[model samples]
Target: MPETGSGRRTLPTVADTEAFGRELAADLRPGDLVILDGPLGAGKTALTRGIAAGLGVQGRVSSPTFIIARQHRAGDHPGAIPMVHVDAYRLGGDLDELDALDLDTDLNHAVVVVEWGLGVVEHLTDRHLRIQLHREPESDVRTIVWEWIS
Candidate 1:
């Protein structure tokens, strides 16, 4: 089993982070909400990129910081679903401005990955997977904690 942030397990490299993401992706479904919390350069986008790959989404998976969000459609697989990636870093204060963007309407059909998502977007759904990334001080390592709440 993978360790949470409170545990001693550490992520030594970028590939480990991506691999952990792929493992987590196996449990995802449409309408699933993922909230990612981390500081700058903590590999939030890297994990999302791994998720996109796991979901069979082709093309590049880049940060949507400037554009707010980006959608990636699954290819080849008939039952594949879509993914909605959102960046909440730019939305200061409350998420009213972010909510005004009408992302709730798209929540039904795609897997939503919200970066810098903490208190702002947690109320969007009662059920969600919250991932917290922490950087280690002694080394270039990271610790990711995934919590499934319903």
Candidate 2:
């Protein structure tokens, strides 16, 4: 298993952001929880898309804003893990609503990723990867800072 660490990156394009996510996924496991904090247009969904690709999960990864969550099954690769992508913006900090989704249960079988989940999802796990994305003013560039918190 990879040790806990933190780092920052400047992504020049959407592809760069996704590539970074793919790299991050290399250290993830089935029970990992990843919280993404960012404003609108920060490429959170794109990063999740990359993570899905890296994990070899089946499905076209997309924002779960409307549905709140989406589960992607593992692919054919040995030891492949599934992914549960979530958009928590609509939850409005309601823990009950969050709990209704039973994400903690999914964590045991999939990598649970929550967007807009800084304060809301941390309690679901003892340790988690927190990633903050910042989009430059009036530009497509993005800066991402992340760390594994325990």
Candidate topping TM-score: 2
lDDT of 2 by residue, 1-150 (tens): 254988888999999988988888898998999999999999999899988888889989999999999999999989678999999999999999999999999998999999999999999999999999999988889999998999
- Report how far residue 76 has shifted in candidate 2, in Å: 1.5
What's the lDDT of the predicted structure labeled candidate 2? 0.92
Number of the top candidate by lDDT? 2
Candidate 1: tens digits of C-alpha lDDT, residues 37-72? 999888899889878877777679899999988999
**TM per candidate:** 0.88, 0.96
lDDT for residue 35 in candidate 2, whole number 0-100: 97
Cα error, candidate 1, residue 122 (Å): 1.2
Error of 2 at 45 (Å): 0.5
